[model samples]
Target: MTQATAADAATFAVAVPALGPDVRCHVLQPGRPPLFIEPAGERLLDRAQFRQWSRTVRPALDALILEHGGIVLRGFPTAGTEDFADFIEQFPAFDGGYAGGRAPRETISGRVMEATRLSASVRLAVHSEMAYRRDYPRRIAFFSRKTAEVGGETLITDVRHLAERMDPELAGRLATLGSRTAINFGPRRDADDASYAHMDERGWNQSFHTEDPAEVNRLCAERGLEPVWHEDGSLTVLNALEPFVVHPQTGRKLYRSILHMLPQVENPEQDLERRKRQKYPTGATLGNGERLTDAERAHIDQLCDQTTYSWPWRDGDVMVLDNLQVWHGRNPYQGTRDVQVALLD
Candidate 1:
């Protein structure tokens, strides 16, 4: 269906206003259209009030989500972990995967950005965390521990909406390009004073290729994707001809890509080699020969930027976003900006 017609089955209502600018604690009506609540206050609700509200509104909210995709709740006070956990548990949509503040573990990306001394000066580009993995998160939770000095806005774009806007031919072409992305942890320091090493023996990359090879080949051919294998045992697999994904619940299509690699990171050539080595130590190859042109790369970048929607952060702001429908990112800023994130299956 189309964007204008997609949310015809959902309903929403403003449940209460706690505090903050354009923030509203909303309770979505069951089986109704999608709702967006922007409250105008900066105060947070006390724990007892929060618990009461959750009990009063959860069923309708849960039913609404089962029919629609998701909802956004804003204008909550920024407090320590216990308060947030209490609030999250009251809603079924929370998925019980807490991130941020004191209880900042169990993240889907497996990376934690602590808030105590966190800075908001870094800009995060549009991307779905762990998108390269075969089993990625379905939902993401972000609790803002602090606001930014300037331009540290959170951006999110609905990929499903973008797909609805694209031409059918383009959509079909993208769908055929179902992809296999390889990522490397690459000896990064962990919170426990240890490093996570890239493993090749376990076939972290190659072994994750669970899609049908023949189908992948067929789509690769159609998309001019050139799958290549390098001498250093690195494999370049391309599947740029897949049609966009259609969400089972929302019936919205999403464009997919292997652009998860942070292009701005150092050592492009070396990084590519490392990725290949980690994924295909014994050497690997792709069936298609499609190489992205400068124009195509620019186009993709523009698309990513334009499709993003950012939520200006406030300490204690919790955002529940559909990982499949929205691509989220952050703008660079100054000062400590800590956030805890969680992913739901």
Candidate 2:
């Protein structure tokens, strides 16, 4: 047999993935919201085989993810936390760390982190990852270490389409006003300190990785976050960014801001204070500093629900999301669930 030229390696396929089934790929139901990629084959890939396959399909997979927002790769050879992070390393520009994120996360390895620790009964609302920060990741990946026996779907929705589907009047108002998020972080405190029950959910020392208030201020300023220190040894951070942003990859307008992970209520008209009281006055407001009416926020929440899509997590499943185009959330579940996240810049 004659040896193929080096050029054959650079551009392996001419017709853009004319050759497939290096493992089988499956999409979700035709009308379903989230794209599912199930690689079906008799045997799983060894490390070398997975690396080779990654280089071969990086182009096609990149295009597909940018176009679809999020895609799930199911039934792969991923066996555990370290193995999942290794698979993600094949892709380029993976920062391999979750930096500047508000929600608490435990670093499981160099590139992998334990997913949110929120109780199964609690719900994490749909929002873009670190949209409040000036420096935010462009990509996020999730791995299901274990699936809950009962209902727990990782909610995902297209932010661009969500923006389009929103009521024009509300959308226009948001675009004109933009949005601001005020996050208050307490001073350095033990994670299980009894005093924290009355303090912020996350402490400033943890968020900024420093016990020195001056260092926190410096870090916040560098990231376009304005910090105000209170007499009670707590810091309130305010970040205001455009509500609409152009996706770097697709050049399409995407819904870029939202009040994240707030507790939902039956009636917002009376519950605004309830949340304010419950969350220590951490809520989103207009760029000019006017509050978004509870009604308006409720409407936005409804639009998100209209577009929400998810499926039951299966062990060894991996999901990659284009952060600019997709917003993700957690669904309330009954049994135990283990989902891990890795963010890429």
Candidate 3:
């Protein structure tokens, strides 16, 4: 195929006030929130050129994210964690790190982390990053280093659209009552404890990077988490958070709840079954501690489905999302996938 000329690149470029003229931009899909960006005629694939371009267009990129909610930068030459870290350095870092996050992640480079270590068969529901907490990153970036052989598309949705489509009564209740998240950091068990062998749990020591209970308590306090300690060295924190937030620039109410991801019992019967089998269950509830009804959960799930979009990942593609404005998830896959992440405020 013939390479796109500089003039051809400019012809399809989206308007960015900071950059006088630039390469092409495409919407991820018709009427979708994320705008797609790729080098057309520019040497953005060159490392030095890519860095210079990223720095020069920082302001424009900021504007684009707020206006469009998210954007995908594809066809960039990010071969490893170092390359991804270089690109992330162009933007501000989120200092909080991933200390209290739910994902099983490992540090790949400076402020860059492996996206997740969950089983490929496990499908993740869409959620605003760290929405379960009182404090969360304003922005999150995902860099794709490898693509799965089948499936593994990153699902995204605009929470603003979800808010618009929500049932008025449910919205009213959530807005008024807010919500709470209960995160359990399972206890350490000895080799003799066969009961703990089968459960999937991340120890509190791993979550907080400290074995000292006092230090863990201090960290929890700083994040507005109410910690409850168990005799078996386990910890559970309760976080009361608002279900929605008004976008700083647009002033529109955006749905910020993790209702789609929260663990729930199918019914009262299942609730009894879970209590008998599990000691510390991580889940969410209304501020008043009432379980979300099946109908309410179904309605929220339906609204998310209506607004969701997903596309296959291409190696070296990076997705930047405004955490409050966009919700992200993972689809189950058949082969290997390597996606790294970085957070920004």
lDDT of 3 by residue, 1-345 (tens): 123347644223354436434456766344467877877666777888888888888888898888889988888777777888888888888877778676666677779987776667667788888877877888999988888999888889887777878899998999888888877767753222211211135677766766788888888888888888878677788888888888888898888876545542224465456556544456678888776798999989888888888876799888899998888988878878888899988
Root-mean-square deviation of candidate 1: 10.3
Error of 2 at 224 (Å): 0.7
Q: Candidate 1, residue 44: CA error in Å?
A: 7.8
Report the number of the highest-lDDT candidate: 3
Per-residue lDDT of candidate 2, residues 103-141 (tens digit): 666677877876776556556678888777767778888
Q: TM-score for candidate 1, please give it.
A: 0.60
Scored by lDDT, model 3 comes in at 0.76
Ranking by TM-score: 3, 2, 1
Q: Ten-residue segment with the worst summed lDDT in candidate 2?
A: 10-19
What ordering of candidates by lDDT runs from best to worst?
3, 2, 1
Residue ranges of candidate 3 with Cα displaced over 4 Å = 1-22, 189-200, 264-280
lDDT per residue, candidate 1, 1-345, as tens digits? 212224433323444333323344333344222344443443225556555655666666554343344555555443655555555555334332221111112332333323212123334556654443333457665667656666666666556555656556544544554444432221212232111122222221222222344543443354444445445433344322232455666666676454322432223465467656454321111114233445555656666666555544566676666677666666766655556665554
Show pairs that collide, candidate 2. Answer: none
Q: Of models 1 and 3, which has the larger TM-score? A: 3
C-alpha positional error of residue 274 in candidate 1 after TM-score superposition, expressed in Å = 7.1
Q: Estimate each model's TM-score.
A: 0.60, 0.84, 0.88
